[model samples]
Target: MKTILVTGSTGQLGNELLQLSHLEKDYRFEFVDRSQLNLASEESVRDFFTNKTSSDYLSIINAAAYTAVDLAEKDKHSAELVNVDGPRNLAQYAKSIGAKLIHVSTDFVFDGNHSRPYNETDLKNPISVYGKTKSDGEDSVLEVNPDSIILRTSWVYSQFGKNFFNTIARLSKEKESLRVVADQIGSPTWAGDLARVCFSAAISDQSGIFHFSNEGVASWYDFAYEIVRAFGYHCEVIPIATEEYPTDAKRPAYSVLNKQKFRKTFEVQNVHWKERLYRLVEEVKGQKLT
Candidate 1:
């Protein structure tokens, strides 16, 4: 069995990937969270690979990142450390051992500029510190190993981790009405869908940048409305403009990605946003722990 290393084992997507261990019997997996390996420290990163190489691990799936989008504005250094420097270290190590690197990135790199969905070829113009650092991370990975696969996704949510879906699901119970930004529109990708996509891409002939997200576009308000309905709640989802719900970062009005490259290259298809959301709700309901 081929052994693969998965970073950020505790994250939303990483946790989802762990559940697939039974489903993916061909690959033997070793999971690592920040406590297991620190990407920011080159010595720690170097040491992690040094040990992994001793075991002859051949691939790395970098799912760890400092994903606090709003907080990144104030915590730029920490974001850059984890998002940029960490990946650079991993890329360098991956290149050294001829290991394939699958790096997860965000759609925030494109400042919501285009009318249509963004393709892999679209120019990146990140407006927020979080996006800037993530884009930098992508460049570093590609620079070190051209064979690396970088998956750019958007509005990632899951039943496992801290995300928009569960946050709205929780908050709806406390508040009679919730206000969400309506101007911004993009795909609400399930972490499970993305995790499977990552596994497929890493094992396949595909190597390069790919956009993975659930099919169909929606605003935060639209997503919130769906979540409230899924919870069987009667809370009103108020659609507010971006200006009304202002943040430090300037979010793109539309950041939908055109996933033609991923679909064609990896032969992987994404489910619609609504179906993915429904299934996630079901999963959450099953656990009964959330």
Candidate 2:
């Protein structure tokens, strides 16, 4: 069986990939968290790859990233290390070993100035530290290894991690009312669905940048409202403007990505955001019963 190295094994996407690994019996996956493989330290990353047998792994799925948007402003160094240097190191190593590199990125790379959905060829103008670092990471990866596949996604949530879905679910049960931003719009991508796509991309020889997210667009308020409803919570979800909910990081008002290229290239149909969220709610509720 071919080997696939998955970094960030403890994250939402990493856990999803682990859950789906069983379905692909042809590949042997080695999942590792920060403790096992630190991306911040170039020496650490080099040491990990150096000790491994050459050509033992067929691909490296870099799912690890410093995704704290607000905190990234104050913690720029750490973010740059993980977001930029880490991918560069992985790409270089992958190039040396003749292995494919599948680097996961965020939709924040583009400033939400466009009125319509963003395509892969759109120019990137990041507004926040996190976005800038991630954008730099993509550039670094491509420069280091042109064959690397950079998958950009947004509003990622999953049942297994601390994300928007779980946050709304917990708040709905604890409080009777909630307020969410209605202006910031993007697609809510379930981590499980994203993981499956990543796996498919890894096995294929497709390179360059690609965008993937659940079909349909929604604001944060819509997302929270759906979560509350799906979980059978009676919380009053009040929609608020972005000005009402100020944060350290300035997020794009709209960052919806066009998935036409991804769909065409992969020949796969993306599940609607509502349907995926309902499925996740059912799964979470079922887990509670067990």
Per-residue lDDT over 192-211 for candidate 2, one digit per residue giving the tens place of the 0 to 100 score:
99998899888888999999
- Residue 279's lDDT in candidate 2: 89
lDDT of 1 by residue, 153-254 (tens): 999988877888878988887799999998899999988888888888767656889898999989999999999998888799999999898787778789
Q: What's the C-alpha lDDT at position 99 in model 2?
A: 86
What RMSD, rounded to one decimal, does every model reach? 1.4, 1.6
TM-score of each: 0.96, 0.97
If candidate 2 were superposed on the true structure by all CA atoms, what would the RMSD be?
1.6
Tell me how candidate 2 scores on lDDT.
0.92
Model 2 worst lDDT run, 10 consecutive residues = 281-290
Candidate 1: residue 244 lDDT (0-100) = 97
- Flag regions of model 2 displaced more than 4 Å: 51-54, 286-290
